[model samples]
Target: MKTNTEVVTAAVVGLSGWDALVERYSRLVWSVPRSFRLSHTDAADVYQCTWLSLAEHLHRLRDPEALAAWLVRTATRQSINVLRLRGREVPPDRWEPESTLPTPEDVAIGSDRARRLWAALTTLNERCQRLLRIAAHSPELSYAQVADALGMKVGSVGSTRSRCLAALRVKLEASR
Candidate 1:
């Protein structure tokens, strides 16, 4: 099997590599919405949208070797959009059963300690929140990929993560 780097490199060379690109990155693309705990239907929508986005911008990609990062970033954004749109929908009647699908927030903040951590997380600044969330959720992503996703300098990711973690610890302690 071709590695991700190889696949992306091939894909960038010509339209002939389109199928290889899709086959290679499909799992990575699908996992984003699933990690967000989007329903199967919603996840399918996100998966399709992410691939469509890649197809639309394939020829114009600034760094074709970074295709995985691009796909992940796109999927994450699409998942967030789905959640936002769902939020604006009319609330179900009291008799209706709650959605079986957990929200992204719920997926991240499952345990009691996690709930506390999440509360602390909410108190942090937007940058910290974003960085930590991306780091926490996308463990498979390299520092470069995370940096690309967040539009940060690659060297800054570790330092920023450390600082954000320190701030989170402070908040966690304060909440006690």
Candidate 2:
């Protein structure tokens, strides 16, 4: 497998690595808008827009290795833009219901243990929730990318993650 840096370098030179870039970052990109609780359609738009943004600026990217961070930042901004646009709409009651069907991920995690873990996750503060979600959903992300995405110092990522996991453990233990 090509490293992210290699993929990015290839992309900068030609189109061959574009698919790899998209494949590598798609989940990380999708996770951002989902984290905002945007509707599916809105999330899809954010996802596309994020990729488009990357495509438009690919050659100019200062550090190709920071692609994950760039994607995260772009997706976050797009998600926020979507929320702001939705806020301007006059008819709040016309909102479509979110899908009731279980996503593949939902089915995969459908177990007593997973349910309990999710319940415990919900009890965490917003920062912890966001941090853990990003970390969990994109295990390939570097500490630098995670820190850039979260606007945290890179040095603090490991410590904060440890503390957050400890808190989650406490919550899980309490529930038992």
Candidate 3:
């Protein structure tokens, strides 16, 4: 498969390339504003603005591989701008910076959550932990693949997942 950079480079040279890029990044462009919990109309506006901005600047992109990041950053900015235009006040702390690094407070909260999650996982039997961990982190894993990996029937995966999740939830609530 061609890398995003290659696809973007192709896009700059012809209509096909531009269409391909729109197909590839449209979801990404739409998702960022939605992540901020924007109204559907606002999100649509941000999505359109992000793409329009991208179209204007495509020729100046120094690295086409950074297209995804660019779209996300653009979408985020556009979302915030839309909020501001409506006089909506997003708490400063609630804002995500264009840089992806977590803030210190975010790191602390995330660390505590991770510790709790790991402790909860440890309370599960090895099989439950293994299944949950694989399924949660690896979206690419199909039900058949998970069944084969865990030596279970594919039909059983959903029920097993529900039981394991209930078990994990019980553990989490108990810890709290």
Candidate 4:
């Protein structure tokens, strides 16, 4: 059996790689909505949305090497849109706790905490706030996406996010 890398090279170069396509990327697709800490209702909706986005846009992806990253980006973008449509305020520059598919009560708790945290987040700077929120919301986000979003190298996303989260925590606790 051809491995994922082999298939990717085949796909990227525009050869026969359909079997490997499904095998390598199905899990990546499934993991999209799961990456968000969504409510059950929201998860299902997000899953459907992610698949629809993939269906609509997958063919436009020229770089087969970016298949997984593309799926994740689609899922995240769809999830964000769903949250916004639900009347939540989604900060364009940072992830919001209220963006998840949570019950009102859960949203209330998270929002209250996040409101305080956001205030602190602002103190740290926009970049720190963005990184910390992404880390908090999507533990599964790949370094490539993080790097793209933050304009950093893929390999550095994890360490940069960690430091940002630590700084946010300190600011949050100090505000309490």
Candidate 5:
């Protein structure tokens, strides 16, 4: 009496279900790095390591129902470890400041400059804040996708993002 989905779901309750397991949990794995404050490259590394660790823990997963939670927890721990390791590694040549952009001391990570910028973003109206947050999620910001995700008309995305960035900038300068 089981539907195809139910049969597949049953297969996933054991070793024969690993492919299904990977398919189901992949997004959860990806989301860990996506939601985390880590950089994109760092997030990718964390995602990969999370899967590797999951493979090791496969047989030990006491509850198959807990698979999603397990992937997220593993990804988080791996991200923290990677972040700690990065703090000690020498910076890459390409990691140098963008000459066209602001100076490193002026706008480096965790600097007052970045903090003020983020604080200003919080001053935006709720919708604008969410739009900008979604836009900022990936290195390559996709206004169309962001609008879709936020339930906005795609046609309005470009102007909305422009306005949001302008507002953010004004707030930052005002704070300065």
Candidate 6:
């Protein structure tokens, strides 16, 4: 399998590298909306839109090696846009129960703690949330990937992470 860097490099020169890029990052893109509890159809739309946006911007992307992060950031934004559009529609009062309950391991995380953590995450600016999410989920991403994704200087990821964590901690504690 081609590494992300090789796939993106091939894409830049008009090779068949886009297929590889899509295959490499499509699941990561889908996970964004899945995390948001978007319906399968809605999540698929976000996935398609993210890939289309990436296709349009690939030539101009600042760092080919950071393609994973770029796709992740794009997917996150597309999911948010999808949710906002959905929010504008009349929400149905009746809701169907989920087909499956969460796993025992998942349930072990107390609901109150999860709620507080989610609330704390929301207290962060969008960039911070994106940074933390990407960093947390994909530790393989280098500082360069993160910087390219979030439009920050490479030197600042650690400092920014520290500040964002402190902010989250403050919010979490204040909520208690």
Stretches off by above 4 angstroms in model 6 are 91-176
- In model 2, residue pairs whose N, Cα or C atoms come closer than 3 Å (at least 3 residues apart or on different chains), thus clashing, are none
Residue pairs clashing in model 1 are none
**What digit string (tens of lDDT, one per residue) describes model 2 on residues 1-176?**
99878998888788789988988888999999999999999999999999999888987888887889999999999999999998989785777567867788878767767889999999999889999999889999999999999999999999999999999999999988
Q: What is the C-alpha local distance difference test score of candidate 6?
A: 0.85
Over all chains combined, what TM-score does candidate 2 have? 0.51
Clashes of 5: 0
Per-prediction TM-score to the true structure, in the order listed: 0.47, 0.51, 0.48, 0.37, 0.43, 0.49
RMSD vs true structure, all candidates: 23.4, 24.1, 19.2, 22.2, 19.3, 24.7
Residue pairs clashing, model 5: none
The lDDT values for all models are 0.87, 0.91, 0.89, 0.73, 0.76, 0.85
C-alpha lDDT of residue 125 in model 3: 92
Residue range 28-128, candidate 6, lDDT tens digits: 89888899899999999989999899888887888777877888888888889988998888666655457556867677767878899988998899988
Candidates by TM-score, descending order: 2, 6, 3, 1, 5, 4
Q: Per-residue error at 6 for model 5, in Å?
A: 9.2
- Which of the numbered candidates is closest to the native, going by highest TM-score? 2
Writing each residue's lDDT as its tens digit, candidate 3 over 1-176 gives 77887887887888888888988888888889999899999899999999899889998999888889999999999998987877866768889887878889999999998999999999899889989999889979999999999999999998999999999999998888
Candidate 3: residue 137 Cα off by (Å) = 59
**For candidate 1, lDDT tens digit of each residue in 104-168?**
87786677677899899999999999999988888889999989988999999999999999999
Candidate with maximal lDDT: 2
Task: Compute the lDDT for candidate 2.
Answer: 0.91
**On a 0 to 1 TM-score scale, where does candidate 3 land against the true structure?**
0.48
Cα deviation at 4, candidate 5, in Å, is: 15
Q: Which whole-number lDDT from 0 to 100 does residue 173 have in model 1?
A: 93
